[model samples]
Target chain A: MSPSLSWIDPGELKETLSRIGISVDGPPAPPPSFRPEPSEDQPSPPPTPNTEASPPPPHFEPVISVAERIDRFARWLEQLTHGAPMSIADPEGLLIEGRGLPEPLALASVALDRALRPIRGLLGTHQVGSVTLEIDGGRLVQTIWVVTPIGRVALGIMVERPLEPGRVELVREGLRRVFDW
Target chain B: MFGLTIASQKGGVGKTTVALNLSYAMARRGWRTLLVDTDPAGAIGLSLTKKLSQAPGLADHLYQHTPIAGLIVETKLKGLGILPTGKIPADESERFTNGLADGAVLKAIQTAAQGRYDVVVYDTPSGFVGATLGAMRASRYVVSPVQAEPIAARGVMRIFEVIGALRAKGHPVELLGILLTMLHTKTQSSLAVAEDLWKTLPGNLLFEATVPRDPAFLEASAAGVPVGLLRRRPPPIAMVFDQLAAELEARLAPDAKDVANEPIALVD
Candidate 1:
């Protein structure tokens, strides 16, 4: 989905200047010069309000909106945990793949079913923030840690291999949210 | 299946070197060895390779509710596998031993490694008693490497205290062997220290081999190469390790012959 951003109006410049205690009667024009004064630096040029947009004062990265962060984290968690039965879905709905079925497929199907139950509650409150690629033998195993108000919550990952660094970051953000780290 | 944890109450006495060389020595001789780096700092993993950059190390598995296998890594070398420590925070000791013994972390490491490796060698954290005890419980034998110095020998007594504490609690751990590391050929202090230890400690727990104080030991460690594989004109350290591995095998599983006779079936 294309994210819609609110457009800023230049007219709001007046209000912004007032915030810094600058009188909005735009700086007074320099006295009219017949053929602008050309002496060696004889006349003061009109104080050109530094028009260049000063980059916003560096601040702690603004708190990420809760929903947006969650979405990003979910994508990473899903990618890393692609085929594990205990699959976590976006912030709300989920399907936990049960351990393989008893008769091979039968028991696994059941494990997949029960695993999804905790995800909805997890999604509602947390964002996946970090992914730990655990190695089991030569293959990959994933555990997604989430950040929340109380503490870090770990979501069992079902992925069989490791994810690239870029993808791991998004999941880390989500987990940081779920775990409150 | 029994396990051995080679650790030190102190650092730089060839803990990682011993652990890595012993691991490589065993692996090269064909005993499947699984090395577990439980130091949240991951020095053991660092000595083995340069690939890993973060945690989910053995310690991470304990706090996070998940399968421990997620942290195990198969090294580039043959026969030696590793379970690396995860993003080790500077305060892992504070967190790991907030209340419980550091061994709590190792219990999970042991559980995770069961049935997977014939020999699980844990390179534990230095200083605190908790990490040592944690390694002790999960390990069948606790081997310490002491440099031939007054202080390193004193450290041995300190380790014995920690082991004695564990024994009082009913842990079946044994002081497998004490390796007098970093031997200097001309120094009387080193020779005296080794002699004193032999006289004081029981004969069964001491290995006949002594690792030499050589520049190659540090260079190999810096290059991430084991002494056993050093292509340069290696000092006696490599041979000492070869002997150390054999002594350890005979000490731990005496019924088994040299590493040549054993074929360890690896996990994966």
Candidate 2:
């Protein structure tokens, strides 16, 4: 038995997304970032760090609230990287936030977080380190472990192509500002 | 009884997913449906309410003379039952191979299913091989799944040819439609393939439902439930299958005068 009905073409989905201002190429860019665009004439301000002797004890009690903050940080990283994806996960390997990274990259970042957790225990207070993970498809992911008062914060920056050292340092600086570490 | 086989000549065409979820949808609509897993590689058991035991299944019913009724397991779905492709002994695979080639096994299965189910859906394996032939032989209609790819679209021709040969041989089975599956509209290539298929295929031979590629299926598979039965709100993909099921029911209504004709007489 067969019925006469018009089937929606798959291309229609692309058209629908386009109507909603979403790109078929990838996830839509973060609404042009809620933060104000820096004026061209004004020099960019350096990240400001709290100079207090003891930073407020890492607030770990409400994991939900901390997770929300992590989302904001992830969005900020998205803006900072000009839409380059980033994966952020807690020390326990739970994905705190992520954008643009492929599924395999996100899952791999979780594993990386778990792997780097043990190493964080042996590091000194001021030590922050980055490791490069070679993945399939000849891609590379640069993951940084920033020591926070609460625990280690793992962030992964997906590298689509070769980049300069200054660009990598800017990503690290963004992480430091976002996590306040 | 109306028996529909969800089959394909290519792998990864979403036959099992469609068959299993369609059964659930049919059951929800108050149709007493039975989903039979003819494909040895099918993960139908994993998506069912309970893990199907490694007991004798259709193979035993065919080769060892186990009662088909005994092998039919009730699922969590109210009006649905599952006859799993249970653990077939390594030795029995060869025996069944010969049985399928001769069409004896399928004829027996058809006879047993007669008058018992409102709809019996069979999930067949990849390719137009032994298992697929057995399913095709027993069904009144075939739903050929074609993945949204050029090669997969070409495979749809083989299914039509099989249905044609069966029709010429006096078997009354008909091709219901070609279901496009695993379609990712976000990708240009996926869109190109789908558009090409739509233009090339006869409009009536394409179901109105297009299953989008979604991670929700994986979530449901992992949770051992139909996409519609996922714990949270059912995803859009789930709704797509539900609509497809409803449309199929309308097309294959039991009271639709054409269905009054008896199936080809079971030889056995």
Q: Could you give candidate 2's per-residue lDDT for residues A1-181 as a string of tens digits? A: 1111122233653454334232346432221122234479998777666768657766554322232344455556656555455666555443444443433465576576666556766773334456777776666787776655545667777765634567666656665565562
TM-score of chain A of 2: 0.48
Candidate 2 stretches with Cα past 4 Å from truth are A1-181, B90-94, B101-103, B253-268
True contacts kept of each: 0.00, 0.00
| Candidate 1 per-residue lDDT over residues A35-123, each given as its tens digit | 13347967776674555755654556554433334334544443555423232322221211112101112222234334644774678
lDDT on C-alpha atoms for all candidate structures = 0.57, 0.64
Residue-wise C-alpha lDDT for candidate 2, range B59-177, written one tens digit per residue: 77766788888888887777788888777543344355445644556556656766666777888755566777877777778887777754455444556567767766877777777
Instruction: Output the worst ten-in-a-row residue range by lDDT, candidate 2 chain A.
Output: A1-10
Q: DockQ for each of the predicted structures, in order?
A: 0.01, 0.02
Highest-TM-score candidate = 2
In model 2, the Cα lDDT at residue B172 comes to 70
- Cα error, residue B139 of model 1, in Å, equals 1.1
Q: Candidate 1: what lDDT? A: 0.57
